[model samples]
Target: MRQLTLDLQPAAPPSLENYVSGSNGEALTALAAWLAPDNREPLFFLWGESGAGKSHLLQACAATCSDARLDPQLASLPTSSGLWAVDHLEALADGGQVVLFNLINRLRASDGRLLLAARLPPRLLELREDLRTRLGSGLVYRLRSLSDEEKRAALAELARARGLELSPAVIDYLFARVPRDMRSLTQLLRAIDQFSLEHKRPISLPLLREVLQTSPPT
Candidate 1:
């Protein structure tokens, strides 16, 4: 059989709406509800396990808001503010959370919006007093991990977007034969893309399995 080929150049990151649509169903719906206009200016906390798409949702919201071309001042900080996306709120240390709380408070008083993401829920965050209080009062959303079915669907979608013509049989084979998490799946896909370019071979079950066996531990 003739080998299928895919152009391997990178594309811009997928939008949050599209990324959520491709995520596990529950997360997509819950995020939509939390992001609606009726909820605007209400604090939104997105908590999830790693690889659960919180970053994607945050970036998407930022991108969508940026695209609206609202006054640059409004979208920016200090002189202006519209939307604020604080990624990895869990990484904040010392009095950082309290500072964040003040920022959010000011934005909200001015009728602006704030979106925050973290690996754990806000109440559990080891943060400063005012920050903890603010987080507790916010509308929290969880981005759940993908099921096996959702994982397969997501991988297939990624392959298509990358222009790789893969069969369900092949996708299923890799899903079972290798590490099945989204991160590993993406790593495997990129490796295959590189391998195809180097050896000029199409992505196949044999090629993927070989790559898996020989690849160093991440």
Candidate 2:
């Protein structure tokens, strides 16, 4: 077994490139259109189901905010490069609306941008009229869950990126024995990596089965 130490710190952040391009649709393209300076909106409302790559999109935007070539409009910050992410904005839309309103106003005055994500769309959030209107002003995109094939492909790429050799049989085992989705697959890969390291052995079907049988799913 290779004794390479997995840089767990670096692994903490999921790969954004995989998330954006592999979202099972042209949603990322639509998002790219919205990010264009001319097409850029002061407010952007993104909503989707859990594990639908919402965070990935937001992080990708934030990660590349400094790259003028990617988004020239994203050049200025605090004034123009402002980024706000709210996971459960719907739950606190009413109270949070005022704060967001002020922030948006300030960003506008300074020529900035705002990005927000939630599980539900703004109209259904039941917030203040003005806030609701503001949120509705920008373009909104809904993210859908990945199909089984998409999830498997994503898992394979994730495994490769992590320097793990996940055979087809192991992939099938995981898909059948565990929750068949990107999020769960990712967690399982991490667990397998850890188990392999601790046991000083390569990842195998028997070890994965044992791990699944003992560990609770996240």
Candidate 3:
């Protein structure tokens, strides 16, 4: 018999320190406290639109704990210690809903913590009433997207982290030409960094245009 093997690429590890709080400082603070080892809350639900960094925060929380589980498929809840960080709660099937509902009940009786992320709030999710109510029982947060200025600041911070000194004019140039989102901006910044490294050149307007024109928009 032949054994089947599957190759999977590990996702980049996320950390609370790498996250740019922007306008969501309060939300960040609350999440940091909830993710702390000493948090008393048994459950937390975080809602945000696409690209609002819910996944990043969830993964970050999971990374902080040794026994944490992140993005586990909900056919049934696995018995695990420490925090359980579940993403895409809105897509849970009927069986998953029942399992989560029961898991929440079990966690309520123990020291384990739950962190859930979804595109919509529990009241609006297509889930069992009991499960939805349980999910909403603890602290609920709505993650806000960063503003344009905040995005620029985040890009500048990222550039600095990469040891690239970007001037105000260069920042403004990238902001005007690149997609006005953190994900896209960060990807573009990386591309620029790679291009500069390959060409042995400094990041300037000419190099920025060369990279932008040659590469597809992120």
Candidate 4:
């Protein structure tokens, strides 16, 4: 019997380079600039639909900063220098809203950077009016979803990074049959890669079929 071994450690840290900017080049550029030591912007807000790479960008930014917070709860804001990448800002509770509002003021005073992501713009978030206005005070960008061709390219790039040699035909097949969202697509690709490695077989159409048949749907 062949036992499957699952590598449970966290996946490699997300980086800015691995992110497919696609049509969100401007937003990507802004994020890169904000990471610089001398960026004048104290806050940046990013909003988009789910699976639009908001969390990926936030994590990438957090990886570069020594002191950073992701989706911070009601924790006390650090007074030291660092960036704060808050994902799903809309989900913050009333207490979180107050905390974030105060944090924004402190960051402004210290010239610290804050990056926030949400499904809707700051105006749409059910937060304090002052907090909403504060969020809008800085650079705001809407992350765009990748097009079909861009998604295909991204998938191919991801496969290459994972040392998987997926042919164009296989890529197309996955595109047609699998979920179009990158998060789901990447998860499926990882599953297929694991299955192939366990079976000691190269990734191919047949292998992919087997993996898909065995794996539960997303």
Assess the local accuracy of residue 66 in candidate 1 as a C-alpha lDDT between 0 and 100.
22
**How would you encode candidate 4's per-residue C-alpha lDDT over 1-218 as one tens digit per residue?**
23322243235567798677889999999889888998878888889997788888888886322111343455544546577767788777777777778878888677778888889998987788999999999989999889899999888889899988779999988988878987677777788788887789998887767765634444
Judged by whole-model lDDT over C-alpha atoms, candidate 4 comes out at 0.77
Give all candidates' CA lDDT scores: 0.66, 0.66, 0.76, 0.77
Q: Which regions of candidate 2 deviate over 4 angstroms?
A: 1-10, 20-25, 32-40, 63-81, 160-168, 179-181, 191-203, 213-218
Return the clash pairs for model 3, or none: none
TM-score of 4: 0.79
Which is better, 1 or 4, measured by TM-score? 4
The total number of steric clashes, by the backbone 3 Å criterion, in model 1 comes to 1
lDDT of 2 by residue, 42-131 (tens): 677678887787777777675322221232233232333445444456555333456566766776666567777778788886667777
Error of 4 at 120 (Å): 1.1
lDDT order of candidates, top first: 4, 3, 1, 2
- The TM-scores, one per candidate, come to 0.67, 0.68, 0.80, 0.79
In model 4, where is the ten-residue run with the lowest total lDDT? Answer: 63-72
Q: In model 4, which regions exceed 4 Å deviation? A: 1-10, 63-73, 76-81, 160-165, 190-202, 215-218
How many backbone collisions does model 3 have?
Answer: 0
